[model samples]
Target: MNDSEAVMKLILHGGNARSLAMEAIAHAKRGEIAAARTALSEAAEELHHAHQLQTSLIQAEASGEKTEITMLLIHAQDHLMNAMTVKDLAVEFVDLYERMRASKGVEA
Candidate 1:
């Protein structure tokens, strides 16, 4: 795929991951721990795909290949970064929710 196409894919994956993380957070807030965990897992898978794309681009640049830095690429990177942060926060939220439920004598 071309650079633009790859960047778009990265952005798509990142956006999906971010959305999934948000969904996970919502589920946790509602005390649906299992659904939250599932959403988090899906988000991780999306992030993994995005990371692979980013790594391939980095490797290409490292191997004497010139990469054009475009606004779209920067946006894609931003999306990925934000998604990762959200996913991390979602994990913490899920854990907290589980603990809260346990403390309330509820089965998680």
Candidate 2:
């Protein structure tokens, strides 16, 4: 597949993962740790898949063949970067929510 296609797929996977992670954090805030953890795991799997795709492309490009740069590629790159950043932050949010419940002496 072309670089743009590969990047787009990665962006979609990353976006899906990020969305799931945010929802997981929301669930955690409501004291559903089990559900939150499941969501987090699903998100992580998606991230891993996306990362793997990106890694392959990077390695391929390093072998002397450059992927053509296009607007679509730029867009996907932006989406991927943002998605990854948000997903990482969501883990902290989930943890924070769980701690908030604990600090309030509440049980999930």
Candidate 2 structure, TM-score to reference: 0.91
> Cα lDDT for residue 29, model 2?
77
Hey, what RMSD does candidate 2 come out at? 1.3
Residue pairs with clashing backbones, model 2: none
Quick one: how many clashes does candidate 2 have? 0
Listed in order, each prediction's TM-score against the native is 0.98, 0.91
Tens-place lDDT digits, model 1, residues 45-96? 9999999999999998999888899999999999999999999999999999
> Which ranges in model 2 have alpha carbons more than 4 Å from their true place?
none
**Number of the predicted model whose lDDT against the real structure is largest:** 1
Across 1-108, the per-residue lDDT of candidate 2 in tens digits comes to 777779889889988998988888888878898899889999989888888888888899899889888787787778778878878887898888888888999876
lDDT of 2: 0.85
